[model samples]
Target: YGIAVDSGSSGSRIQIYSWPDPSEVSKEDTSQWNSVPRVFQQEDWSYKTSPGVSTFADKPHKVWDDHYEDLIEYAEKIIPKEQWNETPIFILATAGMRLVPKKKRDTLLETICEKVGKKSEFLLENCAEQVQIIDGETEGLYGWISLNYLLGQMDDYDVSSEESNDSLRPSYGFMDMGGASTQISFVPYSREEIVKHRDDISTVYLRNVGGGVQQWDVFVSTWLGFGANEARKRYLKNLINILPELNNSNDEDDFNTKAVNDPCLPRGAKLDFLHLKHSYEIIGSGDYESCLKTTYPLLLKNLPCTETPCLFNGVHAPEIDFQRDKFVGISEYWYTANDVFHMGGEYNFLQFNEKVKSFCESDWSEIQKNSEQGAYNNVPTSILIDACFKANWVINVLHEGFNLPRVGIEEKHSTSEEADLEYKPHIPFQSAGSIKGAELSWTLGRILLYASSMIASSDKISVGIAPASKENKPFVYGGIDNPSLSSQLGHGSWSFLLLFVFLGALTLAYLYMYKRDSLKRFPTIFTQITSKLKAKYNHYRYLKLSTQEQTDLESG
Candidate 1:
């Protein structure tokens, strides 16, 4: 029995697979016992500012201790003691923990391990359960492989026919963007001749783009002055800015009415808004419009621009003037001058097309000169259109240009004609209708199965897997292809440690100054007491004078 635990940015799941003898088990029997189950559920876990910032004076663990406790309890309940002890569990954690400081991460791991260790020995007598945190690159490859297996794309090879088989081998790539970071990878097929026997199949390359959270953080920070959490908030606020006003007087009623009436907006777009609202409310008392004002400019400036005037109405208004004399030093409000002009005017496809044409035709020197002089006012829609074009290009390259194998018969023969040659193509497998948005999921599943098969046979695949067993030390594997901008951010345990320490010191200094100011204004307890006594004495004198005046009036 083997257990695979995949912990991603959003959630975590556990799968149990029972390896059985092929001769004894039928396909139906194999499928029944080897099924995956989701044993634990928790709120999507990711790194953000921790409550410990004020108390600890450094970045602290972002994961709640209760989450680990719940995980352990869930595992204990689902996995039998004996089976848990004996089964080799491959635990993989993806985006969430990668962003946190090393000290915080180490503390979290220790706490989790301690909790697991405290479990009753009777519950896990024979089985040894071990946890390993997988690196970003490894996770990317695993996801890639898993998606391929689930998609049924990996089984496309035509091994039966010799001539067509060579041309039918599959090669593909993947690009995945999550809330925190993005990854891009490439995989190529390879075959090798066995020394004494026949041959084996394997991958030639598995290269990953960015996996480090720091890189993503820095990319956003240098450009946007904030991280993913902040950028997402600004993006949503911009959306709300464009939303048509509702007739309702109550704000909550207005929001509900708009949401129900305009159901055509993408679900992700809604989620982005919800997440932004929640985060903003939790961190500050500012209204949605004010938050947008604070965040929108940074998002626009940081957004990648191979060409000029990258615009997204969902995040920024087109009228922003990054080059204005008053705005020159304000990095927070900067945006591509072109996007500002386009989004500020009427939103139409034709207007966007004309803007792009102007940009493409204009000389670079002239464009720069106009920008500096604050003369350029046209908004270009090319940036958003370009993003769509890029996504389509990737789809085409992977689906058609890549050498994916096709599983179909090349020829048909009839017994009556002495099995005479007739050329025809027949589908070898039945189509099981395509899933709408599960293409990535299918690809990831396929790659895992392929890698497992290769590893089982000791094949020399380009992608290497560190032994899942605890006896072997964890090792690095895979390469970076088409590196994401985030990958350029520096990441190291020492660097994180230094950053935390510096933050801690700065926090301590601020606290000390605050305390000193308070003390200087209030003084000590003795001085406070003396001041109170003097004020009481003056009040007593006033009361005595009033009593004397009353006595004089009685005598008269």
Candidate 2:
């Protein structure tokens, strides 16, 4: 049995898979034979706090707890009672747990486990083991495997194969961006780079490699601050601000008399102008008025019209003008979906560009300074740009580094040379060293497939999780041998050897210096005696030479 759990910022899903005959099934089949039941959804709330402070009006903690309980209840209801006992189950958890503190996450997990354990008792005489929280990287790999491998979306790439079934093993890289964080993982056909290199070279030399098959090298993720719901709210609020009719008040005191007065309208001639005013007032009072009033003014400012035309086919001239203004308000409402949460189509791109411009022009020095303290906050512009950049980067790396052909490359270009020549390079995708979101996921998926292939027949599998980047550390698990712990021991031994060597050298140098100083300070007695004897002999020789010189002079 296999269970894959995908928890995004907004929601969570639990899937259970049962494999009937392992020999007949492909690796991709394992990922697909699962059922998903959504577990949790984020709650929305509002509040008025102290002067500038904002807090959720509704209790989010309680809402989440209840949601989790409901998910457990749903799972219990769906799964068969007989299937609850002694089934080898795998549970993978991702983004949601990462958002909360470790302690809180543990508590939440324990709570869910307890609830599930209790429910399992009714189904089975003896309940199976409690649910295990899969590591983030593992969960990401599972997602990648399910999406690309099981879905057969990335079938072009060569993966491992089962000898018995002649079925291709699936490889994938996963890039997941949740509400609070992003994770990227690469699952390859093998962890041994040299082996993979040799295999690739041999395949290439033999011309065994097929066209359209491409290896994936990297997977990456970037966390943009705005969630879907938050994006929606921002878009809605912006829409409301541009609508004019929604802002119109029924009170006559609110309008300027001079502005409304027109020389064309007969003075003291009771006309249907009041009716237009009443209609406007009615729209302003309605629930949709908020959206209309906020969007209308901006629409009018941008509309390309030499003169305001008759808004309706047969209405009073004043009423036509009023209705035209109202139509502007209605036009703004049409943008509600695009403005709030998603960036799509031509208009969204234009709006996104404007937002980017505004953000670039705004002062962010304070935020930069406080970034380490987690005080740097993002608005819609930054978030959308970040997501787009990350997404583009992933796409670019997949095409370039991995030799993965772009989906539309052939259709767009008649030949390979033409495709390569005509491809307009994007800045984000051009960089080979940097991997973001989807690219990171792709890399991770490939790595997982590689690891799985290595231990395909083994009872246990060991996987090394690569660090996110050079700046962070990688997590490793399911190891029969812990290399990190051994590495620490090796470091300590080297440090001890260096310490003794340094001290011994220092002591030998000190002893040599002491002996040299002693030799300089005190001369040996034998040397002093020799020096005196030599001086005496020199004196005797001089005397004898003087006497000999006198005798020789006399003889001469």
Candidate 3:
């Protein structure tokens, strides 16, 4: 059993997974348990609060005193008391943590660790150290892995070699929108596209039958400050600066007294606009068409893009083969479409534009009233205020921003061949927080990686198999392909320790085995060997402890 905590921008979620023990299970063994319950035996628990934990990061003391303690107390109630000691709980902060400074982040982590260490023996060993922010690429890759795995894409691992098998392989791309960043990841149509751009791939090694490893090539990219909330800021800033009416002020008095006409906002609605220490009164012109045009520049396709086919602001992304590729949009993507559009279970991409338009043109009084009926009453004013901008932003980002044609909610034709399927102008987007009763997020992918890492430890694979399990140790920051970055992030000591232990152990083993042979040549050989081993082992132990202490001090 493993516990994964996804600390998102809006809220934090806890996912519990109980899979058959890795020591006894394999790919074939999973078939026997498919009919019993949820996929891989998983359940989710979550808590919602204002402004995420990162918002209180500067006040590190507050996190454990309130938020972290409440979270753990809740876990104590739902999780079995006896199993708590053995259950490995991993807390991974996403984009929100990225907004915080490195020093503050480390300080926040230490406070979390300190609290966990004092908790009852319901958590696994080293639970405190397990809490930290995950890099954007890993978040993207894991999200991709979760989506594909849940969709039955990863299960068809046997699809190899044949060109026809490409259709059977994991093909759906993943797009996740959070508060501080957005991620895009998928497998390209061919190796040529990836070979030329090696930096984009996150190499993952999966444990196969009979102690084998399967290497998968996944292309992933993360755009920081491109999420819905952040994008709103950028969108409004650009719109204000570009429109002559908004920026016509030459004197301080004119700027303060003058009200700018803004079409994205509703008529007679007034907003206190602030950006880059500048302030203004923005009045609504209430034009949805003009709103759409204004939001297009936020995509920044106008940037000096010379290298890769960029989505926006010179970010390098592969030109998506929209006709052939399928994607699942999560986070804010699901929120706006599901909550606002009232398209809960399934919806089409084409319908998104129409519904959002109606929403944009609607009066503020009517918009607020929707929140009062049934499930709408609890909606926050801040979220409601930017409905037009956010909806328009999502639509443009999907179509004009990325050049992706409408695709959603896949409907299958019983006998249609992969190549024979028709390509319509608008494809229905299959959006849901959960698929087949199992929740969708990067938690499953973290489980996949965690499970494989355990399996790798037991398998007699190549020399590099150990690196695959490195993520299992929370202390091991960054991926193997990025050694320098990993070291800078504080995983260098592990590599040093591994080398010292390997050389020291090897020397001791050789000396013990050669004792009799050496005795014939020199009487003092054993004494000499013991002295050297003692010195080396003592030095290694001291260094290991010193490194751990230093790390603790710095983080604390």
TM-score of each: 0.35, 0.34, 0.74
**Candidates arranged by lDDT, highest first:** 3, 1, 2
Query: By TM-score, how accurate is candidate 1?
Result: 0.35
Candidate 1: tens digits of C-alpha lDDT, residues 1-556: 4444555444555444444332233233433222221012122211122222112213224333424334444555655677665544443444555544545544554433334444422121111123334444444455445433333333322223423443323323333433333333333222221111111112223211111000000000011112233334344455455544533355654343233111112111111135324321111121322332344353334555433223321221112121220100000111221232221211122343344335433444455456566554432332221221122222222123221222223322222211111111222111111122222232234223322332221224443343222112232232111223233223563465478569756765775777666545444754775566434433333233223221111000
Which sequence of candidate numbers ranks them by TM-score, best first? 3, 1, 2
How many steric overlaps does candidate 2 have?
45
The residue-by-residue lDDT of candidate 2 on 147-234, one tens digit each, is: 3433344433333332233332333333343333333333333334313333211110000012111233333222322223223233
Worst 10 residues of 3 by lDDT: 414-423
- Candidate 3, 151: how far from true, in Å? 1.0
Selected candidate, larger lDDT, 2 vs 3: 3
lDDT of 3 by residue, 1-556 (tens): 6667788776677676766555465555754222111236435355444457787787878776666666777677766888888667777788887777767776776666556655645443332235667666677877877776676655534323424443324456777888778887777766776666565555655554334455556667676777888887776677556655456665544344445677777665678878656786777667889999987877778887656777776766656776666677777777676666665434456566677777777777777677778444365777767767777777877787667766554644223111111223333344456655566788777766665555533544431111112123223321122123233333565676578679867866786787656546444755686667544443343333334523222111
User: Cα lDDT of all candidates, in order?
Assistant: 0.31, 0.30, 0.61
**The candidate that achieves the highest TM-score relative to the unseen native structure:** 3
